[model samples]
Target: MTGRRKQGFILFRDVMHVILAIVIIVMVVFAFLSPNKYAIFFPLIFLLFSVSCLLDAIKYFKNEEHLKYSFIKATIMFILFLFMLLMSTIGFLNI
Candidate 1:
């Protein structure tokens, strides 16, 4: 039962990673195609990264592995996420 549960968890994590990768790729492509609209997509990309880091932190916390490192990374990512979000909103409004 434990083995199966671990496998399931791994599968779920892999799926989430793949989805995030696809979304990031699409965002990058759109940002490149429409350079003028970078303000909108760039912040969104950071948001995704922040979420990914948060998820990693949670996983590491749960697994009792590298707690300090993961939490610190997540904290930094969240701060950057907020900064990018605020800046993008202001930029969008100005334009």
Candidate 2:
């Protein structure tokens, strides 16, 4: 049923949230301890961040009960992620 499907998606979104959080923490620590190796994981970091942004956008679209700023925040995050990704690809990051 639709309810079950929605619940499943919610569960997935929650998992993604947790995974994104962990990835961020790891990325930060790795950056501080091993800056040279951090660039190697930039692609994976980009992927995870993209997924997190996507899940937020999908959740916001599916459930409009959230505040207006929530959508704004999600949109900003998505744009920032894309910008960072593009910059990284162009060697602007230099990290």
Candidate 3:
């Protein structure tokens, strides 16, 4: 990757990390302040984490390093995302 592209990817990854952190904080706060609403954020948290993992996988693929690890992690995250989404939609999670 070119220097500029690599920098952009780094910036994007940083932004994702920040967003993920913020989401987790919000989820925790909600869990404490309003237990009933906490489940609402479950799927969203998983989705963000899965997306982050996907971004990492893409970055690894571009750089030709740790491809298997990144892809495997992304796959796991996506599965969790899907499972959470299903549970939420089915009322099993109470979201």
Candidate 4:
């Protein structure tokens, strides 16, 4: 991969990390402050962003040079997404 393309991928991955952190913080805050309506939305959004990150990671993986920089982040996001989905579903079911 060219230097420019590598830098771009790194930037994208870093941005995703930031987004994941912010969403998780918001998720926790909403879970504590107001668990009625908005709490569920945060998890759904989290799932969405995580899936996007995972797709990006897949792209990175498919490269001929086998860049794996984002692979760990993507896997973490996938795990988090699953957790968020399960909790959200349970919360809704209990409601």
Q: Which candidate is the best by lDDT?
A: 2
Q: Write the per-residue lDDT of candidate 3 for residues 1-95, one digit (tens) a residue.
A: 78898899789888887888898778767767876666666656555555665565555556556555766665665566566556545554555
TM-score of each: 0.59, 0.68, 0.61, 0.51
**Residue pair clashes in candidate 4:** none
User: For model 2, what is the alpha-carbon lDDT of residue 40?
Assistant: 57
Q: Write candidate 2's Cα lDDT for 1-95 as tens digits.
A: 38889899899889879989898779867867886867656655666666777777676657656876777777776686676566456553554
Candidate 4 residue-wise lDDT, 1-95, digit = tens = 78898779778777877877687777777767876766566556545565555655555554565455556665665676567667656655655
Off by over 4 Å in 2: 64-74, 91-95
Screening candidate 1 with a backbone cut-off below 3 angstroms (N, C-alpha, C), the clashing residue pairs are none
Off by over 4 Å in 1: 1-6, 64-95
After superposition, the stretches of candidate 3 with alpha carbons farther than 4 Å from their true spots are: 65-94
Alpha-carbon deviation at 66 in model 1, angstroms: 7.3
Assess candidate 1 and give its TM-score to the true structure: 0.59
Candidate 2: TM-score?
A: 0.68
lDDT of 1 by residue, 2-95 (tens): 8788778878877887898899899989988997867587767766765665555545544545555766676665566566566656655665
lDDT score at residue 27, model 2, on the 0-100 scale: 83
What CA RMSD would you report for each candidate? Answer: 3.9, 3.2, 3.5, 4.9
